[model samples]
Target: MTTTVTTRTVRYPADGLTMVGHLALPAGTGRRPAVLIGPEGPGLSDAVRERADALAELGYVALAFDINGGRWIADPQEMLARALPLLDDPERMRAIGHAALDVLLAEPRTDPDRIAAVGYGTGGAIGLELGREGYPLRAIGTVNGLVTGRPGEAANIACPVWAGVGSEDPIMPAERRDAFAAEMQAAGVDWRLTVYGGAQHAFHHPTADHEVLPGVAHHPRQAARAWQDVLALLAECLPLGEQAGRAS
Candidate 1:
């Protein structure tokens, strides 16, 4: 642990909604590559904020962008009520993500040229839409985002993408996964997917307090392992430390 990670709350506008995002800064940093994080369908939580802090420990500026109007949803139905409609609207999704990106960009310590995005569930979908809208991300990643987007629009993605899902995730069946993979291939996207056996939806959450459906549960082992994979994705794409070397 860096032991000196600092965080701040930011409020911004997106899609006519006032959004709140959390920013985590690394210890002893010059300008560094930035990461934008999207939360699960229920919205931002300690889980997502902790992920941002972890990224800070890795020496990157990280923002856990808020959807769900800056509040956590405890009811599964409520989560779907808000998330589904946004998921259906690509432009709206991109708008929300772009607002968060702006927040990341405004920071003096963030290197705008080297940025990536990672999201869970609905947030993951938003991150993909950000790429599909040509956000200049170095990489995009999602975990169980229920992948499938507007037809023929994926060609706009300009960065590598990584996605993970549970093998038993009913919300993301094999066919949908296949479709997402096919879309990426057709678009010439560098993409990869990892399916963790016996895990269910939201397995990376690390706690059951957020679980409102039997279909979703957290797997600690898988969560730790998946974080490693996400870290590797960032290292390969943004390389926070290497950006300074390259700049010099």
Candidate 2:
């Protein structure tokens, strides 16, 4: 079935930076379950747009959020410098994410209770933060996201979470991954973490160059698998069509 998708740039609040995003809605929808997609780096990219389209094709209203003031950082060091501060201030980051969520919820075609979040890289961390902050998401998905903030914060999460990371991700080591998982377990949160062996950071971005991260290499196979897992989890929790119904 052919779906209608629209792209626009929106400014958040007064004096806040303008965010460029794409909104995709399925045909014949009063209000549909929405998926808020966070970008991997400083801003939105075409790759993220493709993912949003995929979600929309599955019968959802998908919004790809731009969090970096609509600027692109092609340099890894520059990107890190910009993202590191966000990791340090979880509250501020959460507010930014919450703002984006508010935008999604405000959309007339979005079902507030059935909203879900999915992010990559820094965006992944934002997704986890939103989930931990009781954002009313049906499910949350994170990819190669660093663990920030205190472990106890996981107690606030009220929905199932699925996290995907590369076993060889230099940015987020395997030991840290285990520690994060342990912390979530201790907090009694329903969470699952998948580490793809031999894959590196940004493995899902086929166009990403290895030189971009020096030693990191993208594994197309693992990336494909991770995408499938994310979609499956969302489907299980949010479903589509009449199955979604009205979120309670």
Error of 1 at 19 (Å): 1.6
Clashing pairs in 1: none
Q: Taking the tens digit of each residue's C-alpha lDDT, what string does model 2 give over 1-248?
A: 66665555555641166666677666664778889888886568888888988887777888888777777788888888878887777886788788787778778888787888899987888888887776778888989885755758888888888889988888788787987788778878888999898888888887776778764667889999999998998888888755445542
What candidate 2 gets wrong by more than 4 Å, as runs, is 6-9, 13-16, 241-248
| Tens-digit lDDT string for candidate 1 (1-248) | 45478899999988777888899998764788899999988889998998999898888899999996778988888888988898888888988988898899999889889989999998899999988888799999999995777777789999999999989777888998999999999999899999999888899996653347877888888888889999999989988558565432
Candidate 1 error regions (>4 Å): 1-3, 209-211, 245-248
Among the numbered candidates, top lDDT falls to 1
Can you give the lDDT of residue 39 in candidate 2? 82
**lDDT minimum window of 10 residues, candidate 1:** 239-248
- How displaced is residue 90 in candidate 2, in Å? 0.5
Query: Would you give me the overall lDDT of model 1?
Result: 0.87
TM-scores for all candidates: the values are 0.94, 0.92
